[model samples]
Target: MENRHAPDSLDSIYSIDSLRARHQQLAAQEPRLRIRERALRLGVPEAALVAAGCGVHARPLAGTAQALFRELGTLGPLMALSRNDAAVHERHGRYLDIQADGPVGLVLGPDIDLRLFFNSWKHFYAVSENGRHSLQFFDRSGEAVHKVYRTEHTDGAAWDAYVERFATEAGLPVVAEPPGAPEQAEAPDDAGALRSHWLGLTDTHDFFAMLRHFKVSRLGALRAAGADLAQPVAGDAVEAMLGAAAASGLPIMCFVANRGIVQIHTGPVKRLLRTGPWFNVLDDTFNLHLNTEAVASSWVVNKPTSDGWVTSLELYGADGELIVQFFGERKPGKPELPAWRSLMASLCAQPLAA
Candidate 1:
C-alpha cells in the first residue's frame, strides 16, 4: 500500500507498450502478484495498470460512479467488491435499493450493502479478462474505490447491455495524484473533557462529529475517553471473535472500507479459513479476506446509541489506518444484542495491562 508516489501523469511515466512490458516482466518475476501490487512496483496507481490495457480487454467507461449505480440493478446477481490495504469484502447479491444524493449514496439491497463517497471516485472501466467481466472504479490517485464483479448467476445480457451503454473511447490518459497520508490522532484534550464528549454521544454515527469538534483522532479520542469506554485487546481478537460467532450462530456486522466506499456484511459467519497470513470468511453469499498479520492494534469499543450501548471490535494497521470493524447486527431503533455484547466481552473482557 505504499502508493505514496507523488501524483503524476501515469501516461508520462509509462507508454502503453512500456507499461505492458514492465508489468509482464514483473508478473513473470512474481507470478502471484496482483495488478495492484504490480502498479505499486511500477510507481503508479493501480488504475494505470488497468488503463494500459484500455481499448483491449479493458474499456474505459463513461460517466460518474453515481450515474453508473442507477442502472446497476440491471446487472442482477453479482458480487460487489471493496477493500482497503488489509482487508477485502465481497458480497454476492442483486444490486437493488440504490439511492444517491449529491456525492453520497447507498446500495441497501439485502445481499449487497454499500456506503459510497462519490467525491473520491474519479475513473471507471469495464474490464474483461479470461471471460470474466467487472466494472472497476478508481480514485484520483488511481487507488481502487470499488469494483462490481459478475458472478455465475449474473445476468449476462444485462451486463453486456450496461457496458455497451457506458463504454466509451480508449479513455483519458491514466492520471493519478499520490494518495494522501493516513490520518493520525493528535494529542487529544484532557481526559475528562474527552470523556464528556464520549458520554454525550447518543448516536454512534455522531462519533465522527464529536471527533471533529474536539479535533482528536479516532484512536486519540479512544485513548482519552477512559478505559470504561475503549480498551486495547489482543490483536488476534478478530480471529477469536469471528470464530466464536460462527460457532454460536451469532449474527454480526462487518465493515470494510477504503477512502471511496464502505461495504458491510450482516449475518452469521459460517465458515472460516486461514491461508498464509490471511484469514478468510467463505460463506455462500459473502466472503471476507483479511491480512491478519498486518493488524497493529485491536480495540473493543462501546458507544452509546439511542437504543443502548453498542459494541464494536476495531482493527488498525501499524500506521493507525483502520483495517476493518465489527459490531452486532442491530438497527437504529433496536437495542444492541445482548449476545453480541457477551461475545465481545468474553473475547477481551479485561483491558490490556499498562
Candidate 2:
C-alpha cells in the first residue's frame, strides 16, 4: 500500500487519481497509521480512498452484505477483525453458521463469533496488497465496521476465487451523511420504578429495552440503579482481573465493537503483552489490542437474569463510548460462574464514594 507511484503533482488531490496517489504517499510515510486513520487525516471518507483505487488492488464488492458474508465459509480458515477507535479484535477461524434475519446477523461458530447489525453496513471491498488480502466492510459514513482477512491457514487460491466472484467495477461509493449530535434526554425522575424493572429483569437482553422505556442513557441508568446493581470500580482492576483469569485458567468472554458489528472472543486468553498504550492479548487464534489510555471509567455491573445474576466489567471512553467489556464465559441456560462472582466480589470490595 506504500507509494503506489505518485501522481504528476499533488494538484486536484480529491480526484480519483490524485486521491490514490496521496493515499499511498501517506501510507508509505506513515506506515503505522491505518487506512481509516490516513483517510481521516486526508479529510475524506475512507471508502472514497478505497473507491479511488478500484481498478488496482482494490475491488468494489457487490450483493447484499449477508450474501457476500455467506461465501466466506467456502474459502477455508481465515481471520475476522472488528475494531473501534480504542480497541481492535482479531479472531482466526473459518466463517461458519452465519444467520441473518431482517437487519441483524449472527455468526455462531466455535472459533469466529460475531453479532452484526446490517443496517449500519454499507461499502464492501476486496483489497489485496503485497500478497495480503482482506474483504473490508464500512458503514454508511465510510467508517469500517468489520473485515475478513486471509490468514496463513487460508488457501490463497480459494481466497482469490471468492474475491473474483464477488468483485464489481470500481467507483466511489455513495455514502450517507454523518449523524447530528445526540439529544440528551432529561434524566427520568422515576429512578425507583426503573430500578424495580431492572432488578426484576428475567434476562440481560431485556436491559436495553428497560433503558429505552425509561429514556435514560446506559451510564445514567447505572448511576440510578444503586450500588448493588452497578458501581464504579478502580480503573486499574482490568489488569488484576486478567492476571487472575489467566492464572486460574478461567475462560471469559470479551466483546469489542463500533457502530456496525460486535466481535466476541470466547475461551481463554493466554499471552499478555503491553506495548505503549495498548494492552494486548496475543493468543494464536484470538488477539485483542486495547488502548487502555482511552479508558475514562470502569464499572462492575450486575444484571439479574432468570438463570441467575450475571456480572460484567464495563469500560467506557472519555466520550462515553463503550471501549470494551468482559464477562465470565457462559451459555444461555447456564448460571453465572460462582468463581467469577467471587473474583468480582474481591475486585469490587472497594467502590467510589458518595
Candidate 3:
C-alpha cells in the first residue's frame, strides 16, 4: 500500500506589490527630527530624508540615505499591516517575502498583522503599538547584528533575570541578560533525582520478588509430582485440566510432554500417590482421541514424607473409567528419600474403587 502521509507546501504570503505600497506610505510619513537623527547616525545627508519634509535630496549621498530611509520606513508600515490570505495562514504568520532587487522582507502575525520587515542594506527596526525600537543590525553590507532593546526597570529586570536562570537550568543558551543580573551559577546535577524518579515509576523490586516466588513454588510442586514430562497435549486438554484444577482448589502446574503431543497435570494429595506422563499400561500414552468430548478428567497426587518432600505421581484418565492412567515421579534424584517419602508411599499404596 502506498503511504498516505505528506507535508504541505511552503510559500510566502506577502507579495512584492504589498511591500512596495507600504514602503511608499512610510516614506511620506517620516518626521524631520527623526530623519536628521537617522541621517547623522548613518552618515547620510539630511536633505535626502523622506520624513524630514525636504523631499528627496539631490546630494551625492542622497541615494544612499534614501535607500536607508525606504529600508527603515518599510519596517513600521509592514508591522501595522494585516492580511487573511491562505498563504499567510500556512506559516501561522511567519513568512518571508523574497524580493528580486532590494532586500525587502515581511513577516505576518497570528492576527494577520504584519509583524516585521527588513530593507536593502542598513538598519533593522521593529514596531509595536506601544513604541518603536531601532537597532543597527547591519553595516553597509548588512553584516553586523546588535541587540535592540533591554529592560532597565525593576520588573523587567527581574523577569529577564529569571529567564536567564531558567535557560541555564534547561541547558539552553541564555540569549538576553537583565540589567545588574548576577552571573549564573552552575546548575546542580540531576542524575540522582532522575534515577529516583525512574525507580518510583517502575517499582521493580516487588515485581521481581513475586515472579521469583512463582517460579520457585511452581518448580518445586512439579518436581514433587514427578510430572516432568517434556510434552504438551492439545490445547483443549490443557484447558480442561486447568479448569478441573481450578474447581478443585488444587495448586498445580501443567506442562506439555513430548513437545505438546500430550499434557501432564501434577499436584500433591494425601492419598493415591500418582505420577505420570499419564498413559494406560497397554496404550503407552493416555489417548486423548478416545474420548474427544469428555470434559471431566482425573489426576493422581501422592502424600508427603516426614522431610516434607512429596513423592507424587499423576494419572489422567477419562472420568468414571477403570483403565490405568499415566504414572510419574518414579525415581529419586541425588538427594536421599526422607520420611515424607514413606508417608507419600503409604498414601499412594491405598486402594480406590476406580
Candidate 4:
C-alpha cells in the first residue's frame, strides 16, 4: 500500500519534542496544589481538579464544547478573578454556538495531540470567572445534560482512580501505561523509536500531498466534462472531486465557481454522445463541441480515436505554474488513483482536522 502521510515539516511548528518539553516545564513551574487551587476557584469540582493535575486519563476537551467555552466562558463571571482566561461573547460566538450542536470530540495532550480520539459520547461545557480560571463540565449531549464539577481538594490520586474507572467502562484507548513502583524504569525500544520517527515524518508529508490530490481530482473531473463544453456530466465525478478536495483540507463548495450555470451530467456522458457539436444544457453559454485547440494545449493526444476520447490535463495555479495533471479517463479500477485514496484514508483516521 502507498504511504499516505502528512508532511514532517509541520513538526517544526508543532513538534512533539518541543510540546513535551513545554508541558514538563510548565508542570514543574506550577505546584500541584496551586493548579488544584486555581481549578477550584473557577468552580471546578474536586474530581476535575484532581484529573487535570495528575490523573492518568487527563485530557483536554475538544469540539463544539471547547469552541463554545473559548467564545463565551471568558466573558462571563467564571474568570473574574482567576489567572487563566478565555475570550467569549464576541461576534464569533454565534458560529461557535452552532458548531456546539454538531459532532465533536476531545483530544489529549502532546502524547495524543492532533488525535481526534474520543472516550465517550459526551459534551464538555465550561463556565469562566472574570478572566481568571475556567470551570469545565463533561456531560452527555442532551437538552437536560447534567453538569459535573471538580473541587479544590481533588488530588492526583482521586483523579487517577476516576480515569482508570472511566477508561475501563468506556473501552477507550489508554493514554499511557500505569506508573510503576518507585526506582523502576520503563524499558525503551530502539526499533519502536525508529518506527515512530518515520511514521511521524510521513504524517507531515501526507498533509501537503493532499493538496496535490485535490488539484489532480479537479482536473480529472473537468476533463471528464470535456472542458466545460459537455453540458451534463456524471454526479459521481463531482462527488469524487469533492471527496478528494475534502481530503486535501479544502472546502466542498470551493470547487464550484458558478452554481446556477453548472450542468451536472448525472450518468454516463459517453453513452449520450452523438456525432454532433456539444450543446450547453443551461444558459447556452458556450458551444457543445470540444475545442481541439484548447484540448491540445491542456492534454497530450497520442492514443487511437477508436479507444474513446483520452487526454492528459495539466493544472496551473493563479501564477500560471503547473500544479498537477490528470492523464486520460479516470477508470475506477486504475491503480494510480490508490495513492490519492490512501492519502484520504489516513486523513479519515484523524479526528476531522481542527
Candidate 5:
C-alpha cells in the first residue's frame, strides 16, 4: 500500500528529470493523492514535487516575505491553509491587516488569523491544477508553511497582476538540510522560582520566555508548577470539550501550529465527526482534522491577564510537541465567556479514561 523506496536508492536509479516525468504521470492518474503524501512516498520534499511540475503546472515566485504578504490582500477572496502531520486547518477569507516586521508577520483579520515566522520560509510557488490556482509557501525542510487559494469570489485581475509581478524562471526548488533534533532542555532545579514566574505570568505570550528561563518543555513546566497552576486533565477531555461547545453553541478558539506557522479558528463549531484514529470538525467554512491517538497528554493551563484569569486546554504529542490548543473565544478588553469556562470546569471534573 505504500512505496518503500529509499531516497538514495531512487536517486541512483532515476535521474531528476526522469523522476519529475514519472511524478507527472502518476499525479495525472491519482489526482486524489495529496502532494505531501506523494512526496513522502517518493522520498522527496513536497515542494520539490510541485517545483518539478513548474512551467506548465506551476510558476516560481521571487520576493521578500513582507513584500509578498502585503500583496496577498489584493488577491480578494482566498482560502488560507495550514497543517501539521496530525492536523489540518483551513479557512476561506481575505488576508487583511498584514503586518511584517523583521522575520515575523501577523494577519490580524476577522478571518484568516495567522502568526508567521519567515526565517525558515525559503521557497514560494504559484501552482495550477484542474483550473484551481494557489500560492504556496514552504519551509527549509520542504514542509508547507502556509497556502492561499483563489476562490470564486476572488479578483482574477489582481491574481494576474500578482503573478506577473513575481514570476521567475522555471526550475527545481532548492532543498535545505534536514532539521536537526531539538536541544534537550533540562528542567530547573529551583521549583519555587519556576512556580513564582509561572504564577506571575500576566500574558500568555510571556509563557515561551518562562519556558526558556526554566529550560523545560511546556508539560515539564506545568508539572514543576504542580496542579494548582497547570492541572492534568484526561486526554479524552478533548472530545467532551468539543461536544459541549457544539451543544451549547459556545464560541471558542482553536489553535493549531507547525514549525513555521500557527493558524487559528474563532467562533463556533457545529459538527463533530469521528473516524478511527481521527477526530474532525467539519463546518461550512472551517475544517479541523486531529489525530486523537497522537495526543500523549493534555493540560488545562491558566494565566492571569489584564482582563481576568484566562484558561486554555493544551494537548501535547509524545515527543513533547504541542499538538493543538483550545480556549474560550474572547477579544481584547473582554474576558473569556462564562459558558465556556463552566463547560471546562465540568469537563475537568470527569474521571480519567481507563
Candidate 6:
C-alpha cells in the first residue's frame, strides 16, 4: 500500500474550517490516504484532523471510560481498533464484562480484551463516513487511543440510539496540547539488586511495578539483568517469531497499544504479508499492521510464572517505547509451551547478520 507524505507545513496552517476542507479534498483525490499517516506528514496530530470534522462527519461524544464501555455494549458486535505509530491492532467482538477501577478499566471479553487508561482519553467523536459508523477517542496529544466501528452484525437501531443519547452538536474543534517532556528514569543503583528483583518476578503483572521501584527503563533493566535473563535478539525477530508461531500452530497473544488502550489478538496468525514498510497479518476477524522499519530493538525476555518460565518477544520503537509484544497463549494454571520456548531460544541464538 502506498502512503502519502506530508509537506513541511500545511499550506494554509490549521483551523477547524481549513483542515476540514483540506482533509476532504485529499480524501477525494486519494481515496486510500490514511488520516494518521497524513497527520504525521503534515506535522499535525491525528486527533486534530479527526476533530476538524466535528460538525461534518464527526460529532462530539460525552462520557468517561466507564460510561463509554457501558454504552458501547448496547451496540452489539463491532470492530475495536487500537494503534500506535508503528502498529495497528483490530479485533471484532462485543463489549462485555467491562469494569472500571479509578483511572483504569478492563474489557475482559473473550475476543475484545483491552486495558484502558482513562486519564489520557481526553476527547471523543462519533463519526459517520460513507455509511460506516464509529466512535473514536483521543489522548492529550491528539493521538487516537481507541476506536469502535459498527459491523454488519451490529444492531443499527441500538447504535443510532447510543449516538443520539451521547452525541453533542460540535461547536469548536478540539486542539491538541503540547506533549510534555519525558521523565528520565534514573539507572539502577546496583545491577545485582536489579537482577535479583528481576529473577524474583512471580507474575508478569508485577513487572511494571518492579520497573517503577527500580526507576529504570525496561531496556535498562534488561541490560542490567545480564545475558541469562534478557537476551538481545535481531531486529527482525518479530517476523521470525510470527512465522514460527504460524508454522508450529502455536496460538499466541499479540499486544499492540497506544496511550489509551491495549488491544490484544489471541490466536494463530496464518497469513503474513510484507508490503513496503508494513508487516501485516491478514486473517479473518483480526488484522495487524506493523511498520517493521520502526522496530529499533527486539528482546527475548523471560519471566518466572507460577506455572513456569514464560517467554516473550518484545519490540520497541526508536524512542524506547514498546511498539508490540508477543507471548505464547496460556492461562493461569498452564505452563509455558515447550515449542514456544524452543522457537525463542533459536531466534536468540541466531543473531542478525552484520
Q: Whose lDDT is greatest here? A: 1
Reference-based lDDT, residue 191, model 5: 80
Give the per-residue Cα lDDT of candidate 5 at 163.
Answer: 89
lDDT to native, each model? 0.84, 0.81, 0.26, 0.26, 0.80, 0.80
What's the C-alpha lDDT at position 329 in model 1?
Answer: 93
- Counting clashing residue pairs in each candidate, in order, gives 2, 0, 28, 37, 0, 1
Kindly provide the TM-score of model 4 when superposed on the true structure, using C-alpha atoms: 0.19
TM-score comparison, 2 vs 3, better candidate: 2
**What TM-score would candidate 1 get against the native?**
0.94
Model 5 stretches astray by more than 4 angstroms: 1-15, 21-32, 54-56, 180-186, 349-354
lDDT of predicted model 3: 0.26
Model 4, C-alpha of 50: deviation from truth (Å)? 12
lDDT score, residue 170, model 4?
22
Which regions in candidate 6 have their CA more than 4 angstroms from the true location?
A: 1-13, 21-31, 54-56, 171-173, 179-182, 350-354
Best by TM-score: 1
Descending-lDDT candidate ranking: 1, 2, 5, 6, 4, 3
- Candidate 3 stretches greater than 4 Å from native: 1-32, 35-105, 110-112, 115-119, 124-354
Q: Which stretches of candidate 2 lie over 4 Å from their true place?
A: 1-14, 54-56, 171-176, 180-186, 350-354
lDDT for residue 273 in candidate 5, whole number 0-100: 99
lDDT of 1 by residue, 1-354 (tens): 455744365455667787788777877788777777777788877888888882227889888788988899988799999999899999998888999667999989888888988987888999986677899999888899899999889889999999999999867666666565545456575768878877878899899888877777788887777677888888789999999899989999999999989999999999999999999999999999999888999999988767878889999888777899999899889998988988778766564211
Error of 5 at 32 (Å): 4.8
RMSD of each: 2.7, 4.9, 34.8, 22.2, 4.1, 4.5
Question: lDDT tens digits, residues 1-354, model 4?
Answer: 111122234344124354344444555666454433433333332223323333223333444443433333223111111101110010011111212333443222111111121222233423233232233433321111212233242343543443333332222221221122222112222334422332333222242243243333332322332222212223133224334443453311110001001111111111112233221111111112221122222322111122232222232333222222333223333322334333333323222111
Rank candidates by TM-score, best first: 1, 2, 6, 5, 4, 3
Superposed model 4: Cα runs more than 4 Å off: 1-35, 38-135, 138-201, 205-354
TM-scores of all candidate predictions against the true structure: 0.94, 0.90, 0.14, 0.19, 0.89, 0.90
lDDT of 3 at 1: 17
TM-score of 3: 0.14
lDDT of 3 by residue, 117-218 (tens): 333233222212123322223222222222122222213443333223222111111111112322221221343442233233222123224224333222
Identify the superior model by lDDT, candidate 1 or candidate 4.
1
lDDT of 6 at 347: 81
